[model samples]
Target: MATAPGHPIDVHTWSTPNGWKIPVMLEECGLPYRVVPVNIGRNEQMAPDFLALSPNNKIPAIVDPDGPGGAPIAVFESGAILQYLGRKTGCLYPADERARVAVDEWLFWQVGGLGPMLGQAHHFRIYAEEKIPYAIARFTDEARRLYGVLDRRLADREHVAGDYSIADVAILTWAKYHEKQGVDLGPLPHVRRWLDGVLARPAVQRGLAAI
Candidate 1:
């Protein structure tokens, strides 16, 4: 089962926003993969085997048996995984340096800013044992501000980077969880339109259903 002829990707992931990115990319690339669930709630992500693939003790790592030079490759971080898949498949990720740079900008923006802000909003608003108003407002405001940036970016374009690349995949995964972050898309018509367009994609639908 480790080295099958057709199915070479073994996606070790959970059903989180970060976890869903890889599957969405894989599906978008038309790559065959098998999902190995990592139960983070039960500390499964801290296990030795899972940690070997994802040293950060995170879900959504992948083991690609047919990597560069036909060797296996294990990658962590949803952003890194998306970049690798785009490079390997020659899809989603642009070959042109300028276009690739554009994609990287939005992809990194989601990773460094959007995801963390939204995650903090979710924690303070939902998971935290003590609901601190200061923390809640801080994160919620940040999330709203970030959403405004994204909304403006998409005002004239269908996608973040002017084309539907991994940038859209990365951002939409977190954006789709707006309710959990206490986000309101009603005022951001451009973001709402872009989100609706991304959600309507057949690949996105399949990726969201992967888990």
Candidate 2:
């Protein structure tokens, strides 16, 4: 669908997992947007302009020209951005109360639990200044446990939440970095299957390319 007159969606992001979420959603929703790359490595995310959009000093912020009541809107955080796009386009986000709740549950699950744990695992396993065995083992084990939970959740369903909502987009973004996070999917057949399905989408391919 065409955006409101004179107001296009501006996506500010890097090439990280979180950064990929917005592009994926925009593609999935068939919305037109502009990409503004933020080089986190050089501290561009901390710049005054980017910081105004994402006060948390993070990648994947957005400025929607046409927001609620036709005013421009700026949103930060990958999860919130997904929810905004979902609600705006009425594509991945469910309109029904129960279905929306289910989607929110898993979306929050990733934002609060899965993403943070895996991030710690990545820090300890790869980026840390010092190699701490205790930290590495602790986070890796937690990452494994979270993967198991997702594997079981996907045993009967093709998507994380009902009908491939924003929740799947949220978690799948992070789930793609299994190796970097020190996670093993060998025994998580269900998760593997689900990941394959999501990765096969043309929109997902285009979204990943945006990063």
Candidate 3:
């Protein structure tokens, strides 16, 4: 079955959680795709070609030629990309209506809450020109609060929802880096376990690798 020029997919990303999700999903879904690592730290993503697809100047964008009615599709926003990939190959997401919506909740939560909050903490603590104590506290506290949410939710379950799905994958990448970014994980034993479990997946390890 000859699909097209870009049959499987084309991903522009880097070696980050936000970036890692593409390769992770590709590997998990067992889809054949090309990997283009867009280095935002080096202004690679802002290049005119890359910007044409993802104007937000973010990594983790995709060009799926065999998308929606067998046409090319350009998608941005990690959460949106995740949902698309999940629907495409059917991994890390369920077919059940209720479970799928629940997975969407955690995915959106990570994209909105965990991703943004930890990003601020990293910016203030590691990248900010002036180390403002209040700003640092504000973001770091928010990061911990999000971690607390994960901890509480994971207290009695193995994954974010009822099963191991993209919901866990979407959040654990940043949660795993909490210590390196100066957020403590001492009180979140359940979260720690969940992170470890997700990282143990071969697909996850492959995802975290430099593309």
What's the CA RMSD for each of the models?
Answer: 2.3, 1.9, 2.8
* Clashing residue pairs for model 1: none
lDDT of 2: 0.89
Give the TM-scores of the predictions, in the order they appear: 0.96, 0.96, 0.93
Better of 2 and 3 by lDDT: 2
Estimate, for each residue in 30-140, the C-alpha lDDT of model 2 and write its tens digit.
Answer: 887888989999989989988888889988999998899998999999998999889888989999999999999999999999989998999999999999999999999
Query: Tens digit of lDDT per residue, candidate 3, span 54-121?
Result: 98888889999889899899999888888888897688889999999999999989998889889888
lDDT of 1 by residue, 20-114 (tens): 99888888888888989998889999999998998899888999988899889999999999999999988899999999999999999999999
What local distance difference test score does each model get? 0.90, 0.89, 0.83
- The per-candidate count of clashes, in order, stands at 0, 0, 0
Of candidate 2, the 10-residue stretch with the lowest lDDT total is 1-10
The segments of candidate 1 whose C-alpha lies over 4 angstroms from its true place after superposition are: 1-5
Enumerate residue pairs that collide in model 2: none
lDDT of 1: 0.90
